[model samples]
Target: MISPRAPRADRRPVVRSHHGRSFTDDYEWLRDKSSPDVVAHLEAENEWTAHETSHLAPLADAIFDEIKSRTLETDLSVPVRKGDHWYFTRTVEGSSYGVFCRAPVASPDDWVPPAVDPAQTLPGEEVLLDANVEAEGHDFFSLGTFDVSPDGRSLLWGVDTEGDERYTLRIVDLASRAVSDVDVIPNTAAGAMFSPDGAFVFYCTVDDAWRPDTVWRHAVGSSSGADVTVFTEPDDRFWVGVGRTRSRKYIVVEVGSKITSEVHLLDAADPMGEFAVVWPRVEGVEYDVEHVVLAGEDRLLITHNDGAENFEVVDVAAADPRGLRDVVVPASTDTRIDGVDAFAGHVVVSYRRDALTRVGILPLSGGIAAGGVLRVGEIVGYGALTELEFDEPLFDVGVSSNPEWTQPTLRLGFTSFVTPSTVLSVDVATRETTVLKRMPVLGGYRSEDYAQARDWATAADGTRVPISLVWKPGAVDESAPAPTLLYGYGSYEASMDPSFSIARLSLLDRGILFAIAHVRGGGELGRHWYDDGKTLTKRNTFTDFVAVGEHLVASGRSRPDGLVAEGRSAGGLLVGAAVNLAPDLFAGVLAGVPFVDALTSILDPELPLTVIEWDEWGDPLHDPAVYDYMSSYSPYENVRSDVGYPPILAVTSLNDTRVLYVEPAKWVAKLREVGAPALLKIEMQAGHGGVSGRYDAWRERAFEYAWVIDTATRGARDDLESSAPVAPTLDA
Candidate 1:
């Protein structure tokens, strides 16, 4: 219990550059975050991580009261009908946010979500936004556009009291709960929607590098300085957005990056008009879109990737918008599609086959259906379609709230690693289903008292990978290696499926195991496992998460002295490049908000979203072979000051503008200038999905599950030393 003296961080060099090299950063003066000597070195690394883990404040308050007693502190969510209302969200038991409600639709074709007891608040509901009374006097709040409108009597939302992902917007009214003095608007960028006669709203706005690159429109009660701009995206690797078309009939707008996409459509009943595109940014081709209604016309479907490297669904013709054709032609397990919704009777789709997450259901009645044909022995949206069966062999499903394009019902949402997320509804013309809720985990939780499987690993170029796990099954000994905690994030093609976690049942009720590697820059196993782990085959996402921590220490399910790796934000650059490729195969890592100074934020094009992440970390300014492959694995330029590395921590968020609390305050000041065992906390009023209520995110997940179970059972020492400290010094 001693180790305190930490905050050194003063080095100030700063040279940088790209294409024609140049380097020397020395914690680039902690990127001057409004310097009071960089907020006194991040408040002295938050008071030396609160006097070195103030003895895991009673195991982070008994893992934050066993995640607030298996959470269901007054619940609700699962209503969602839309137009004669029903919506839902509620949360109230000592609330720290939730409320957005709705109600009035027990009839006019009511799609049943009311067997009542949603914390007993339904008959005449309404609420529409109360996020703890709009997060009273903020210390980081968040929300970002809750949308409503289309005659639900205006709502739009947005807010953010701190945690810098911009936000603000407003316009409330919903039958006099009043709040609109000329709409408000400010900063922006997290989508906003409405138009289709909810009288204009659109939203988005970010350039100066924060990247949402202009969208605008406004009008509602007007005065965001007369809004307008409608669409801008002058390609800084594309980034603009706008929504509509859950068949409220077109208005999309899109534009993309991280490998091509373009979309654009507009006419949600022509709100101040002008939008068109439907497909035009093809460098590495990617697509998305939904609007259906076939045979009664108006089409679009899309899902694309022209050559179908695991993407196909075609359609086109929002009145022959351009005649593309096919209709779900590509998946022989080359799955990966990921989205498509449409309805007035069927569609769902979502993809990703063998690495799990499915969805299916197509049905636009097989006849001539506008000839956007799935012809040749049609079998519906592919993986032999009509899907929904889920008995868990590694679970995670999707298509959650089907917003009525003439709803026949869809909802769904399942989960796995020991189930508990549930939510069902189904019946898109009798594929039946209907559970309607399952997340009431409260103490007596059991999915057979935990245990999950699926394995794999291999990789040093021979690929394989997979992993998933979870534990408490015989607590530990099926012949050794226990204190695990593998986890990984891979990146952008997201997929980290197998859900469930009442704060991971306080680390599987203490014997701690938890896994999930599923590597290759993520889309689970499709799109060539995220194109072989990103640009220049980005060190195969840190050698496939160091080949699953050396195949969880060669299958004894982890114990290269009890592993302990983690990831966040691009899987914290995949465990900061698998701790410089394998710091003696981990003992503790975490990382959170971590995009570890990737070659000085991808050779800085004015930073934020760095030129739309040049399609996922590649254009290193002007490519000197992407500035030597992002300065050879940029975890703050491959931290090596005489290696002895391991024990890291580093969660961050000084209002993170997406991975920028100066990349983990310069990778924990270069892992405390090489003496290793770094710590750094920082959230100082949150951002980048850090703390915005729920008891400061359940005491930041009980201080990272009490430091990944005290660094995987107290760092069995391979010089990845651990002077036992698990967490403290938190405020904001």
Candidate 2:
């Protein structure tokens, strides 16, 4: 079928210069998203993409339906015991969102989550918030934070109606089931917390640039205009957040940037009190605090990177905040400390060791309900930490839902690429773990049918990069080639941990081998892994991804002819940069909300998050070195007419504040002008994350995966076409 002729974006050149380096952007005119011509061009591009992918509609639909069929439409989460209630969320059939509910606890000390199912509602079930009911008239919906008061009498929730990050804070009387008539606080950020007595709540608000710069304390039922500004960070580079410690004894006001952080503590018992800094902000120090009672002393479980890039845990007295004696010294270059959680009897240490997530339990001795320490040395007081063991070599596991400090069991979540997410309850004292539930996959499914493994590719600098792989047992043949999709994201020190995806099953069954490149710039291996991939070393991120794509071919895992590269947001930048560096290495490139115009965006400090991102991308505007370094790799500026670029799909949203839609819109326009097979699909009503709602999300994945399969297959039509799973009949 002949694809529709795409609309041509008029060349309206805009000269942009930074540190004596200048470039002309012909598609810069497309940045005016509000203009009718801009909308028409995007709409026309959507039409052309639809025409090009018309034959894959059945394929997309089949995958979407498969996801829906495999997923349990109605399900209930494990109830978490908080005060006198067991709080949980349930999803119903035909519901776009979840319903937050709670059931009365048999006893306050009962830590086990109720054996409840959405199909059979438990007695005395009280619904606190029905997101479906609340999201009745909105194009986008997100629950930034939802928390219950200390007495469990009221609920404070934050909601974002649009794709924008700002949320509206609301209060509801749990007993009366009536929304409070008080004026709601709008434009609040994440990490909102209630005071111990439940009279007041502290939340953060963004400045003009959409940075969460100011934190405020507001009386629950009072007008938002009467709220008091508790703290404000004058620096545009730092973002602020407020939250109560896990112990519920201290309220923390955290302010930090990419490289530095400072935390202030307030006694939760005192609502109108001043906060004291635990440690003065050091130039390059980043630390997180958690209140804990150790050996009869009030202390903060501090995880800081004083000199250790991977960070180490130290116990500092709450009274003598400046005293930082080490409890657990940093591991030599292996384990990267992610975070810590404090409980009455123990501290849960979360870190990444050996490139996979690891969780350990550090037990406290001689601790009581009230505070008092025996005055032992920091290192000798706490017993040796015990590591939680998981059989799978590659899996994502972490702690959560541990509301009560005195609770005996720790709630954990675990999932691997081929394993359905399982909720586990661990007995703190016994070290025994009990699997509460494995998410139900409705359609007939078996984990044994799938396979997952890890491989490594050596970089140009001799650094080995790990690649996580997943596929059906017979999905690929080493003797021949198979359609492959390589995904990577190497910015912000984020690790793309292995997790199960029902939608991914469709691709695996369709003769596709999916892999994730644990490239540099990510904290997978350690902090240095990320350090070597950002700013001046940013090229390592792109090159590492290309190296993995090349390794996958050389290792007989997959061939270059049928390889596709995929990434979203920062990952989009990864995929985009890789294509520019080696266009012929990939059969197609799927970039979602890509930061392709890295140099252009970094030069403008006024854009949302632009200034705050300097730590990650470097100061390109003022630093001539950074400017030249970034200009050499910025995807948009590097698009050349001479190269035979791959078929590219650039997906973006109009309302996104993080990575502007204009980046991909302009990237695709330039690619098309250069005679490359490229298309742009815009989600007009969505934000940074595409369309909300599980159904919409499923359909979106289906659209992208269908395209990935089609394009990857196009490169080697006869490689595995005979073995590919056929689209299911509509009636099936």
Which is the leading candidate under lDDT? 2
What C-alpha lDDT do the candidate models reach, one value each?
A: 0.79, 0.87
Cα distance off (Å), candidate 2, residue 678:
0.8
TM-score of 1: 0.31
If scored against the real structure, what TM-score would every candidate get? 0.31, 0.95
Cα lDDT tens digits for candidate 2, 1-732? 765698788999888876666798898888888899999998999898899889999999999999999999999888888888888889998998999998988875677777875788877898899999999889889899898889989889998878888899888888887887784888898768788899998899998888999989899879999999999999988999888899889988998999899999999889799999988999889999998886678888888888778888887788997865765545457678888898998888888877889888877873322211112234655766677888887899999778888988999999999899999999988889999999898778899889999899988888899999998877666466678999999999999998998899999998899999999999898889999999999999999999999898888877776899999999999998999988989999999989998888888999888899899989988889999999899999899888899899999999899999999988988888899989899998888989999899999999999999998888677645867998999899
Provide the RMSD of all predictions against the true structure, rounded to 1 decimal: 25.7, 4.9
Q: For residue 376, what is the lDDT in candidate 1?
A: 24
Which predicted model would earn the best TM-score? 2
Model 1 accuracy (lDDT, Cα): 0.79
